[model samples]
Target: MKAYRMLTEDEVLQLKSQSCLADDWNNVLVSSDFNTAYVHHTRFSGNVKLGSFDGEFTLKGGIKKHAGLRHVTLHNVTVGDCCCIENIQNYIANYEIGDHTFIENVDIILVDGLSKFGNGVEVAVLNETGGREVLINDKLSAHQAYILALYRHRPELINRIKEITDFYSNKHASDKGAIGSHVMIVNTGSIKNVRIGDYCYIEGTCRLKNGSINSNADAPVHIGYGVICEDFIISSGSHVDDGTMLSRCFVGQACQLGHNYSASDSLFFSNCQGENGEACAIFAGPFTVTHHKSTLLIAGMFSFMNAGSGSNQSNHMYKLGPIHQGTLERGAKTTSDSYILWPARVGAFSLVMGRHVNHADTSNLPFSYLIEQGNTTYLVPGVNLRSVGTIRDAQKWPKRDKRKDPNKLDYINYNLLSPYTIQKMFKGREILKELKRVSGETSEIYSFQSAKIKNSSLNKGIGFYEIAIQKFLGNSIIKRLEGVDFKSCEEIRARLKPDTEIGLGEWVDVSGLIAPKSEVDKLLDGIENGDINRLDEMNTSFETMHQNYYTYEWTWAYNKIQEFYKLNSDEITVQDIINIVNQWKEAVIGLDKMVYADAKKEFSLSSMTGFGADGSREEKEQDFEQVRGVFESNPFVTAVLKHIDDKTVLGNELINRIGHLA
Candidate 1:
């Protein structure tokens, strides 16, 4: 607590001589060490408390400015020690400004009545028609928003979540807003009922209202020129600048929305980037990036997605209000100028290349391609598993994470072949086999879920899914027996047994955290039963699931191994283990070769057309090599080759170790 004292008569006369005026000298209270020499051309009204202005701030280019109140009006405000408040066009009211904060040329920063600072503001995300509303709060996470937006079928769960959020909001409600230490709000316009955090830099921002910038010294936030936010909660390490406008939004950690991007009623989770685009009521999970002008993302749910230039979606057929919504699972991408009518669900890691009006649901066929020809949707399943771009995307996600705060809100799983996608591949294989069985094996094409799949694509999809499954199961078994020196078949079987039974049935990607559905069901049950009532507890549950992922994954993979190989665990021998290892080796090698072939296309003759402009063919090849290195020397290609070599060695090592067990 600061020890405030009334200004001495001589000090008040000195302040008056310095052109500082107060409604009543008795209304102003100053710290014991306050100096009148630093008070100049300032006006004080209503009860005001001033701290000691004894520190000097060093600016760029070796300039120094003494910390004091100059040319400003403060009302019922408490100015902390060592702060410089200058040139306020209008009075700042009901604010507790912290130490070392510099507020200059700010117009009308005030808190009117009691404000929650944007908490309890319901952002209608995912579905624009107003059914799914995620309450914006400082503790909002991707998983919380996911359940709140998609779990509408369970009204009790939604109500419980809302109650929890409301409780949090009410707990933080305050009559006075705060500006934390080391903050700089310069040349801003009309900040009302906003709470700014420590180390935040707000310069040239316009009209921020009812928000909380949850910035801290560990991960500071920067709101730059011409930015406007209303009813928002921006988490730590985020930058909202360059005329970006937000309304009723919750931006998560390390997100960047700039370059005139406009978003309304959207929930953008960790590391999402939006530039020069407009989003309306979208639930953008972690790593959703849209960097194109005229690309509008509306009424959609997406995670780990990239929207190409001019990519768009329609949520209404003009029959009713905009009531439809769609979901693009993790790692999905849209090609330039592509469009999708809503009420559709694109599977994880799928590529959409053209306009499609039909509401095709490919949730069971992950890692596929959806193309449109003659207004007909064509599905090519499991092809993306071998694409060099897909591999690069999966590799880049973890590397691209921008969240620097130690208290990260999102639990992101970066594995491309987890139980989530593997379960989809399993269903896809079954669907393909069923199609082949129903429509004779000689059929040229098969129709599924309003999309057509050619016989060749179907067969290739089966092979691709098999390779992926083999790779996953083999990986699990190898890891399970990684360091075990088995001397007999009994030991091998015992080692192959799962350590837990938590991952037996289905699994789901809850935004980015991939866990078994049964575990999620238990969490949901707890939430519904009112056992898990706090946001912190819910996040802890998610963290527990994330920490135990490999254990749960082994359980799922163990069951799949028995079903896929038709092997009983007790009767399995070293030869069976060796057979599985050989299959895993082949699958690994085959996939690497496929990725290498796909990468070679980047160096193909057709791809070199625009490389050496106005040059002969030989010169073009030379220029192409200079720009994009040779296929074998390409980094991704080299990695693929190295992966093949390492997998071969690993398989041999495992075989040699298991060979002694026989």
Candidate 2:
């Protein structure tokens, strides 16, 4: 650190000649190479330090009018090299401006008092009033925030986590604000108690109060025209532009908030896009996107979810103060004009249609449709299992991950069928069976969790869940024995055995990361015991669990093999393998046919209504075919047919292998 030095007597006289005044020239210090040639029409107040201005910077947009610092005051400020601080309508006090930064036509960039720049701002996510407030920080991940917001019942765990977050916040607390290197704050209004990071673009922003724009060179944040943010931490690579308003929000990596979208007390994780919509007190985990103007997402937890136009939720019953909340689990979708009453839980990959007053909880029955019949909520389970859109969404999420930064805060798992949903399927099958058992199986309709399930829907749901279960287990068994050349039955049996027994039981989807319930419990226990104190360490545990998913999945699948085949592992015959293979082949083909039939609905006459706007029927058919290629040649259809062929060959090959042993 260089020693602070006062301006020379001659320099002070030269500044006096130029009508510049300093509160005691001794209070102002500058680097040895600081040039007074560029310090024209500038005033210094309180304690100020100036770095060397020897470095030249070529500003973007070819407006090189850099020799002005008129009508601006600096206090206890350290101005770095090549920074043009001009037309600051109000003073910039207690700040450190970095090199190559352009601060032109800005109003009041100041740190009024001791500020942490919104590091420890508590956001009451689920419950609006209080009780479950998450202390947001620079490194807050979705999993950490999830646990902190939802697990408030365990006070000790919450306190321990809060203490850790407080420690982090205290470590970052500073007496002065910082404007990082290469930042441009041109034509902005009112930046108070905020920290601007490196390479950030804050142009024409209305106001930024008490926040941290965590922009960097790799993924710079762009706060464009009319943006207003308060008590926020916008992570790297995000764009908050075009009249967007944010309050008490944690905008995650590579997320886009634009086009008048307003969010308050929401946590939007990686790759979440909000355009022309409004979100309030929502926990938007990774890839929760809503681009419709009329959509309003309030008081919910969602991930990989797409909200259709006019899709909304009711958080108030006119009794309590907006107390109710809902959970639309991962990959859940809503059609246009769809509505759900709060205190509801829609399962993973489920599709919701129309308005329903009944607060249905279908958390165990994933891939279902919750449709409204008259005023009744009708639940159809496992129908979305073969949906091409579901598969396409799963495939697209990974490709659309926009985080260019090396350090990813969110750990997202994009598997369509994991132990998380599979375990739910297991429970869902039991729940349906129990529904039938209780209703006598001959009932016309069954009631469950504020929703009605028709008799045919119940039977079809059971069949679908069974098929999915068998498919998953058979897939695991086949994968386990994929590369192994089993010359004998003993070798095949040995190969089928799981490497580890840790993943035999229930599984959970903690936001995006899917792991066995036992593992999550261990992590929570670790946090409770002060073992997993650091946030990074906790995230590493999550990563470890995610990495070991396949291993644990095999363990769970291996245990279910005997139950599915009705053969004890100790007394297995070669015919058991043949029987399972034949069953697997049947399930695979059956699902394919259903998917094919579902795909055909897309090419129906009803689907061609809007196509060929002014054309005859023949032209309409041609236009529809031209726009959406012939069904036989469609990629998904071809893939389905090829899947049938491949599975047939695979089953026949397995049967042949078993026949040799017989």
Candidate 3:
């Protein structure tokens, strides 16, 4: 609370000599440290307040300018200490400019009537005509948005969440906007009904209307040239610039949207990037990226996905007013020119390669490849489990987190073989077995969902799922008994017991945080029952769930082990643990060998066609080695081989400890 004093008559005379005018000189208020020396060519009206000109701003070229008002019109504005306001094309009204801030060059900054600054704005996501609407706020997380958009059947939860959001929005409503400390707003056009936070940098922006830039010293928001945003909230560490346009959107922390990217009615969460693309009514979860000008993501939900050039999807197919929507589960990829008809759900870590209109649902068959052949969808299940690219993606996500803010809004899990996908493998194995049981084993092709699975592909998929299940279960048991030396069968059985019973049921991936479905339902029930009524409380629950993922996962794995291996937990012995380790060693080696072979294909002779132009095969080999490196010595290949060796040694160490009992 800054105290302002009426300007002395001598000070008013000095200001008049400096060509400063006020509607009534008595209406102006000045701080005790306000000096009339730098106040020149400024017009003041309607109870304007001025702080002291006690600082200097250094420009990029090391040129210094003393902070004060020059050639500016301030109407009902309070200029804070050491601030500069100059050359406004129109008046700046109803704004509280913070200390040490610089505001210069072009257009009006005002709040007309009362504005909520983009909070509680209903973004009609997924089903654009109506149904799924997410009320976006400043601190909305991906899990919250996921529930808001998908869990519409529980009307009580939806109404309670919306009412909480509305209360928050109304609490923040104001008649005057604020521009915070250490901000730089230069050469910008109209800023209307926007609240700019601390350390924000806005330059050459065409317009910013009804928005909140929640910037701070740890993570500042950057708004660059030709950007236009309305009814939006740009969270900390986000950059929206370069002719990008956004309407009715919420961009979460550490996001990047630029290069003429356009989005509307969408929510982009942490680590998502968009450039030269367009998104409409889409929920883009963490790591969802599209970098092509011809790519348009519409009416879809995606996470950990990449869209190649000219990738597209048709939600309505010119019917039903664009209400149809689709979801590409986490870690999915689409090749160039690929397309899908809506009401489709692709499994996690799958790849789509061609145009398909079948609306195939592969949510149970994760890590597969969906291809189009003669207008029929071909399903190749669990093939991606052996893909080097899949392993690389899983390994890189944790390293590529862009969130620099100490306080992260979304708690993400980057494990590729978590209970979420492994449980899907369990269901997928059962589904494949059912398909084989119904269709004769001699049949050439079998149908499941809307895709066709060849007999060979089906058999191969079953084997793939089995190997993955073995690998995951073995991993859990090994990690649980990592350091313990068991002497007897009873000791081993006691060690195998789960720590908790909460994760005995199904699991789900809520955008990025993978946890038990029971836990998610428990939280939702709390929300509906009025036990968890605040946004912070919900986020705290999510954080707790994320922190305890492994504890809960072991519970889920314990149940599956009994089902998959037909073993009673109380009767399990040291010999059984040794056998599990041996099988795990085999599974790990098999997958690693497949990955190594996949890497070797990149170094095949045919891959050198365009290299070593007009040269012998020997010369081409040399050129290929020079550019792509020798096959055995390549980094990924060496890593895979090393992983095999490490896991083998690990399994033997455990076996050696328990071999006597076996």
Candidate 4:
């Protein structure tokens, strides 16, 4: 807060000579060190405060501009030291422009009446109807939005959370907006009732109204050419540009929305990307991406998912409103030109191809393929477990996290094989077995959930689920006994006990944070009972859950061990450990082999058809090898091979260590 003094008569006279005008000289206040030379052709109205202009800005291409006010109208505005404001088509009113900031060629920057700057804006996510609205705030995380959108049955809980959000919003509601220090607003249009943060860069933005650009020096927000945002909160480390338009949206940390993407009533969380597409009433959780022009993601809930070119969904039945929605759970992907009629649920890590209106609910069957044949949805369960693409996706999500803010808003878990999906496999195995039993074993096709599963796919699915389940159980047990040397069966049992007691019963993937459903229920219960009263408190709870995920996962895994391995904890022996280790080796090695083979398919002769445009067969092979590389030397194939060797050695070492007890 710099001290300001009234302009002396002589200084006012000099300002008049410099073509600067003030409605009343007495109403204008300036810093003691303010220079009249830097103030030129600027008109001031109402009560205005001006800071000293004593510096210069060196911009791109060696262009230099002295810090000053020129050709601009200031109405009840306070200009900080060393700032430049010029070429405003309309006046900047009721704004406190910060130090060293630059504003040029902007239409207007002002606050009218009172505003919360996009806070508490209800984004009607996952449902086109108004019921499942999420009040998007600056601190809105994916998990919080998940609860607000999905747990609509709990009215009291929703009311309490909404009230909390409203209170937080009202706390920041102000009659005067602020443009933070070191900010740049160039070639922009209107910025009304908006708050711009420190180090933000706004260039060529058409209209920004009733929004908060929560940028900071740590992770500056960038709004590039032809962007239009209304009723939005663009979080730190995000980039919105290239003719993108957003309405009633919350763009979370490090997200990118560009290439003429348009979104309305949507909530996009950390690391989500939208380009050349449209999203309506969608909850795009962490890492959700859609990168094609014809893609329309409407009335859906997605996380760690991708929408291929021309992918679309329809929710309206033409009878009722667009009330139906769908969930493409974590790590789901749709192929090019694929379509789904909503109110369906695709399992985690599943792949969708072709068009389907059957509304198959494959939520219990993770890692499956929903292929359409003659408009029939053919559910091939658990086959994606061996797809090289799935492994690559799982490995890349963590590496691709774009959040640069030290203060992260979302706590993302990138694990592909947590208890969440494993439990689904456990249930999926049962579902497939039940399907096989109810339908005769010799049946050609099994009809389940409006989709048909061929007998071969069903049997293969059961086998796939069994292998994955055994792998998870074995991996968990090995991890439990990783560093410990057990002398007796009692010691082994004690070591295998869970580190915590919270993760029991059902587990859920709350957006990206996988945890026991009981624990999430506990958090919800807290919110309903008024114990958790603040947004930060909810975030803290999620961070706690994220931090202690492995501990909670082990607890869930321990409880499942009894049912999976048929082990009696009290009477377990070293031979049982040996048996599990042997099974683990087979499952791990066999899965790796499948993935390796899948990777080879990409480097096959058929895949290299177009590599060499004009060449002989040998030249074509050479060109293909140069472009795609040999399959054996590919990074993913090498990784898979290494994983097989590593897991084989790991199981053998464990067996050798525990063989002493026998």
Worst ten in a row by lDDT for model 3 = 484-493
Candidate 4 residue-wise lDDT, 1-662, digit = tens: 57899999899999999999999999999999999999889899999999989999988899999999899999999999999888999899999989999999999889999999999998888777788999989899999999998898999999999999999999999999999999999999999999999999999999999999999989999999999999999999999999999999999999999999999999999999999999999999999999999999999999999999999999888889799999999999999999999889999999999998988899999999999999999999999999999999999999999888999988888887889999899899999999988888999999988999999999999999989988988898898898887778788888887877998888888888887888899999999999999999999999999999888888888778787888777877889889988998999999999998898889888988888889899999999998888888888889999999999999999998889887
Whole-structure CA lDDT of model 2: 0.88
Q: Could you say which candidate leads in lDDT? A: 1
TM-score of 2: 0.94
My TM-score estimates for the predictions, one after another, are 0.98, 0.94, 0.97, 0.98
lDDT of 1 by residue, 1-662 (tens): 76899999999999999998999999999998898888899998899999989888887699889999899998989999999989999889999999999988889999999999999999988777799999988988898888888889999999999999999999999989999999998899999999999999999999899999999999999999999999999999999999999999999999999999999999999999999999999999999999999899999999999999999999999999799999999999999999999989999999999998999999999999999999999999999999999999989999999888999999999999999999999999999999999998999989998999999999999999999999998988888888878788887888888888899899989999999989888998999998998999999999999999999999999889989999887898898889999999999999989999999888899999898888899999999999988888888888999999999999999999889766
Better of 2 and 3 by TM-score: 3
User: Where does candidate 2 stray beyond 4 Å?
Assistant: 1-6, 10-19, 54-61, 65-71, 570-582, 633-635, 638-662
Error (Å) of candidate 2 at residue 371 is 0.9
lDDT of each: 0.93, 0.88, 0.92, 0.92
lDDT of 3 by residue, 62-91 (tens): 989899999999888888999988999988
TM-score of candidate 3 against the unseen true structure = 0.97
Clashing pairs in 2: none
Two-way lDDT contest, 1 vs 4, winner: 1
TM-score of 1: 0.98
lDDT of 2 by residue, 1-662 (tens): 66657889987888777767787799889878777776766778888888776555466787565533455788889988777787888789999988888788888889988888989999989778877799999998898898898887789899999998998898889889999999988899999999999999999999999999999999999999999999999999999999999999999999999999999999999999999999999999999999999999999999999999999998989897899999999999999999998989999999999997878889999999999989999999998988878877887999999999898888889988888888899899999999999989899999997899999999999999999887777777667766555688888777777889889788877788888889888888998998987878888988898789888888888788877677777777677777777778888898888888888899999999988979799999999999998999999889889999998888787677557886
